[model samples]
Target chain A: MKAAEKRRITRMTSAGRVELDDAVAVEKKVRVAVNGEEVMSLYCSPERVRELIVGLFMTEGIIEGRWCIDEMTVEYGDEILVDIPADGKVSLDRGTLISGCLGGVTFSSSAGGGPAAAGEVRIGAERLRALFAEFQRTPGLYELTGCIHNAAVSDDERIIAHAEDIGRHNAVDKVIGRCLIEGITLEDKIMHVSGRLSSEMASKCARWKIPVLVSRAAPTSLAIDIAERSGITMIGFMRPSRFNVYTHAYRIL
Target chain B: MKAAEKRRITRMTSAGRVELDDAVAVEKKVRVAVNGEEVMSLYCSPERVRELIVGLFMTEGIIEGRWCIDEMTVEYGDEILVDIPADGKVSLDRGTLISGCLGGVTFSSSAGGGPAAAGEVRIGAERLRALFAEFQRTPGLYELTGCIHNAAVSDDERIIAHAEDIGRHNAVDKVIGRCLIEGITLEDKIMHVSGRLSSEMASKCARWKIPVLVSRAAPTSLAIDIAERSGITMIGFMRPSRFNVYTHAYRIL
Candidate 1:
């Protein structure tokens, strides 16, 4: 699926107005239905539909017993249509659990969604900086359209899996969902994202047991709290020259 | 209410790690209850709770008939609590309506949110450039933490009202909600925002019938589509010298 499309747009500067083709990130609504019951609409990049669904369902706890991604039918057009036939009884309270702006996901700080496995994987600050620079340089949709956010999973060696979406959370979900489907373990792996470490972003990493969370943007206060509680190593403002380690500094040797 | 707070963070560079105080954006969950029934938790900046609720309620169509923000009580702490005694019945389907990633607000293209009143509110390109530069110059929460998104409602002369929040949609809502409470006519105003013009951002401005929308970032494909459908003058990549007009070019004189 095409993640972006170029269209003629009028550009204006102090000199004058000129017409040129500009690429805009593609975002289409995918209406998801569970067992023929219309459930929700996911606004995201057109690519990675199955990965997005798998990630969303797994993280949102939609599958109770039995489900298969192959049973789902995805149709594309002005809008994408998806029907998932999970054999298990899906929980309907997910809408309430993950509600409101900035992809709000409320994880009870104490007992809820236990802390990520303790991270012992360590890498030098210089090596980590170069790895991140290389990870960012392997751009896909972001280079075409600056509006897209991307997330990637990596080991100490190199980048393994990555996904891009119009929504930052969706991108994280896609990458993590791909790993889940392909049977790749998220334990002791670093997850890198291209947006602020909001509460939901932090919670998603913690829920998936991603040991290290890094972002090019700043982190919110709640994000730091979640990181400290979840035992996840949170890093923000990851510039090439320097970075800030908010929690679990032992991860950086 | 302080929108930001300082915290100690470990900074890592090629040299080594050092501890320094960092100002992180403050985020607190404000549980909103309408008429004694708990509704939704809005994760946002602590300041401007009333404006956030007012903007959220009005834009989300929570108020059916009689409602006033003055009747709302907001208590602050680790988590902010709010109770609103709305005189009229509130719709409960708001959760289903504005659901999912990136503040999705579905607007039907056919008869949905009708096009914004044909915008004749024109501004010279140079004047608009100056106005936007000046608008962005007056910093609030962003200067403190750098994680907050801000939106402002401006007439041709100067900025009238502005708001800041952790969520981009919430910031837009606060400004619009403030105007709704203050009886500011939005039909002839321009909205300046600090993030990408996503579908929700475009829909919110279109829903409010704001004539011109300017941003210092790119617009998604769906955002441009919504802008064109709603007769909004969409300008993005709004740097000091250049910008791109995706729709309704006539609004730029």
Candidate 2:
């Protein structure tokens, strides 16, 4: 991962102002080509480009089972290009513009239609509060630029996988992708994000069948509907002591 | 515009918990079809669908002149479908997913390549601070739902147009669409938004040649780069007392 750039910028403060060098998050367009066709381009932080692409493919169901990528190469000169095995199964032309903060392309309509997960998990309120506290304290690019979103997958004890990106959806994808690549099971785990819980976010969680989706922000009406329909426990507006469980409250004891 | 819905929700406070009815923003997908082909779908507030589409076409550079749309129909049924004349030139298959929180599709690369604005416009620093104060205080759906993003076009005196949506980019498009549909010229106007400034947001403002963009949040590195290249004055962290001018400081007197 490349380090954030130190750029000289004018800073304004309450008492006065001064010129200073600030650590700004660097972003570039990474064109992901499956086989030979350019499927999509993402304007993202330069770090974790490979993980982002792998995660995108995994979540979109382009590469089922283990990694089907025959070869992967990252060309970092001038323009960044990631070439991966197209494998004849990845359809490049069927991409649709999904409604994510940062631009995203998906192969199918990410509707809530997957089979419901069969499991029961109980998370204590104090545990959630403690986890949220830890989540807030554990910061990186967000603290530097104040312009990134993060998604983390955690067990009852600690965070397992975390990823940050300029796009909330990408962060979620990175976390899921990291888990999948590392062979970590996602069922009955908790997914926490820093952005609002929109239907797209809900759809991503649903696709992974993560039982709990937590955020420190509000959820859209469609997100709530999706969570309820998908049987995922949706919690939002989380703080040190309280949170709102919109659906499947039985999972949060 | 449709009114926000007031729904009952469980609120957990630090002191205790209670059930309350909160005003929530309403969002629905409007499938925009240009010349009869379904190009893309927008998950937006249940209002201003036409302006949103028109603005999208205008920014995307699909219809060159001033509103080349011959006819438009909003089919308000179980599913919202917007039908507009394809004009024989609108290419539906060439859409690119944009990096917006709420997903956006661009017809072409939204590069900062256009005729530069003519003449000079200088906005006073105190006036900008005053305008930002007013901008923060003149809240609408944000006050109601706390989940919506807003983009407002304002002169030195007051806000001229404001649009809110689930996505920050959509709110900007809606604002631009409102301006174009109302025959308002965008030259030398200030675009203020509630979200962080990203390259895509800068691209949107640059496409319209809006002279200055002010945000209450931080800006990514690419946003600054685009703003500097396109001669769009970018300001971030705008408060009543201070702000940071990232580029084109000549515009701020």
Candidate 3:
């Protein structure tokens, strides 16, 4: 992937030091504009610009499903401009700075909302283990640059979509964006991330009504509270053979 | 430390599932007010709230060293308010949302200015290795909650100040704030972090004029560029015997 840049530098290994070519992740400023109005500019890995935009809209509760955009163009090294009809009157001004490594902001929405995916979805312990194993096995941009975080969406048996970004939040955004643009419904899917699940992450799942949120890391207390309130099955520290179900344990058999 | 909260969770191991009390890291909103004016609120570990404010200011270029303050108080489960003279005219409105877990915003400053810690400081490789060894040994809140990231400032021998937070950026800010309030100059000291060193992190060290920045992770391409321009010693993937020097290598003997 073009997400990593090769740089010549001195490396120190266990045995000794040597000069070599190393792969360093590339982070760039991407200004996203909707209907000719500047929404915001953020530093992101430029590989998946389209997914970043679509996922941002889905997580922000902007467009519930496939959005009707008149035109969309990505000018490399410049910006990504999506032209919805002027009558669409989309305003992306209300953004809250998110906590990620490369600095990012998200369009904020009210916490008071209806659950988007409220139907009951259950999975056996072995099935959950297999899904996590799929998450662990899917290699992408992270192997080249150790500085990236990964996120993926899966069904009961296999992962459907996976994304890697400089920020875990963005990684989630990319996955959701891909699904939204591809017209895939997330009503009964599981969202797995490679970083800590915070309140924001849980809220994103709740907004989309995704029933199960899994991570290979721990969850913040606020995340658990939100998961409990939203009726989401929050599972963390997911390994090949084990996992911790924080809230809504009934969903996991 | 109150930073950790005990919660009964069902843990699944290689053997079977068991219900146990686990120590989870606490994340709360700490609102910071300057001169009785509400600046912004951040989700942070409740411990070292004051240092968080100071370190935030230091890294943001808000307050250089210890400044005049009439009153400052912290109320648990409430907000932190610091009253300077009305003439202080502190404005924290220019925050750029940082990419950290739990999400946060950082006040922005122009890249143009005098170097805060511009000068030559040399250190032997052995001394640097010892300092990094100390960094790996001092276990704190991270042991309880694997979700948190840690940042610390150290001398040639021992770690002077350390802070842990749900956000790696916030952790660095906490360490800087502690130094500012305690009247410790970081011109020659080293700043070490447990996460990837991004451009913002490098800029914070450059703003404070910390000569040597050591991390147990890789540095981003933009971070390396900023470090090289700022004339700071940037070292990453720091182990006892191995490390990668990204910029201004002359400082390493």
Worst 10 residues of 1 chain A by lDDT: A99-108
* TM agreement with the true structure for every prediction: 0.91, 0.88, 0.86
Backbone clash total for model 1 is 0
Clashes of each: 0, 11, 10
Report RMSD (Å) for each prediction in the order shown.
6.0, 5.9, 6.3
Task: Write one digit per residue (lDDT tens) for candidate 2, span A1-253.
Answer: 5626776767565665577777767767788876667867878777677677767765665532222432577888545898776434554322222211111222332323447643466887778778777877776888787788888998888988888888888888888877765667787789999998888888788876788999998887778777888888888888776788777777655
Q: Model 1 chain B: which ten-residue window has the lowest total lDDT?
A: B99-108
- Candidate 1, residues A105-179, lDDT tens digits: the string is 222212125545575778778877777887798859777888888899998889989998888999999998788
- Candidate 1 C-alpha error for residue A114, in Å: 4.0
Per-residue alpha-carbon lDDT of candidate 1 for residues B179-242, written as tens digits (9 for 90 to 100): 8767677889999999889998988887778889999988999999989988889999898779
The CA lDDT at A145 in model 1 is: 84
Give lDDT for model 3: 0.73
Which is better, 2 or 3, measured by DockQ? Answer: 3
Which candidate has the top score in TM-score?
1
> Which model, 1 or 2, shows the larger DockQ?
1
Q: State the interface C-alpha RMSD of candidate 1.
A: 1.0
Could you give candidate 3's per-residue lDDT for residues B89-188 as a string of tens digits?
4544333322111112222333225654565578777788888878767888777777888899987667999888888899999998787666667877
Q: How high is the lDDT of residue B13 in model 1?
A: 76
DockQ, candidate 3, comes to: 0.58
